[model samples]
Target: MFFKPYMRSLAVAASLAVLAGCSSTGGTQDGSMDGTGAAGGVGTGTAGSGQVSGTGMGGNGAGQMASTGIPDVRTIYFDYDSDTIRSEFESVVNAHASYLAGNPNARVILQGHTDERGTREYNLALGERRAGAVQRYLSLRGVSPSQVEVVSYGEERPAVRGSNEDSFAQNRRVVFAY
Candidate 1:
């Protein structure tokens, strides 16, 4: 807890180095964090440019890619301390369910996660329940149970790092890795 003058200087330098390394100029001259040439963060959302959108549904899908060429959306979010899927995200789940039902041989791994607000044991159990909820939803919609495998990481695997609500929102999620 005590720092000499030299140690303090070294600590400051290390902190600056870390901040400098992480400072993204929004990814490009156009201020596009999406790495696309466009200014918007949604990389795949260029009009008639055929870029894949951020969510697989909008940016790249059978329809989006076929018509505009965009791809990939793997994460689905959940409410705080709850495994219930929001009604707003039902379409996303439906899309995956439809895909699995249509392709009998296709399989997907559901990775469940939780924010860092609970005990380790509780988070693990919550993660499992979240994944189970997704699995159940998919099965009810016609995706075979055998085609889905669930894994829970609880608070161990967070997509975002921070103590604020914004970060916590990002951390509570279920990712469908095909």
Candidate 2:
């Protein structure tokens, strides 16, 4: 009877030792569990300071407002072979409107480009169409025509240099310069 009780105690001790070993192994894998590691296992998550760390957006995790000092102006993209301003560009138009409204003296140059697939003259026309489309939008947004200048580079300057869709898409664009 005494041997049975002693054996039971030894078994219990062995089980505890095994558990301790497993726990130490886990600790080695992830030290943050012990609270002594950097970030305290929170892993740089959103802390009340409006700073989101380790979220992979780059910068010092100072949140959206800090990442972009001034709210980014939305870029308006155009469809292939068309200069018509799409509905998606409405926000960009509005943002530009607000900026121009606030800064009356600010002047913008609209530069348009086209993919390399078209003849130079045809691409020039297309580029002009693209710039004109943006000018029209800006005019509609209450910016005076004098404050904006439109120029088309056609196939002369491509934003990207490849026959692929990605490069073509990038090449067909209107850029705003202030």
All candidates' TM-scores? Answer: 0.61, 0.58
For residue 118, give model 1's deviation from the true position in Å: 1.3
Best by TM-score: 1
Task: Give the per-residue lDDT of model 2 (tens digit) for 35-98.
Answer: 2334434321111122112212122211123222322543444444445443334445556655
lDDT of 2 at 9: 23
CA lDDT, every model vs. true structure = 0.56, 0.50
The lDDT, on a scale of 0 to 1, for candidate 1 is 0.56
Write one digit per residue (lDDT tens) for candidate 1, span 70-155.
11456766544445454334456767777778788889999989878657776787687777777877887788999999999988
RMSD of each: 17.7, 26.2
lDDT of 2 at 20: 27
10 residues in a row with least lDDT, candidate 1: 23-32
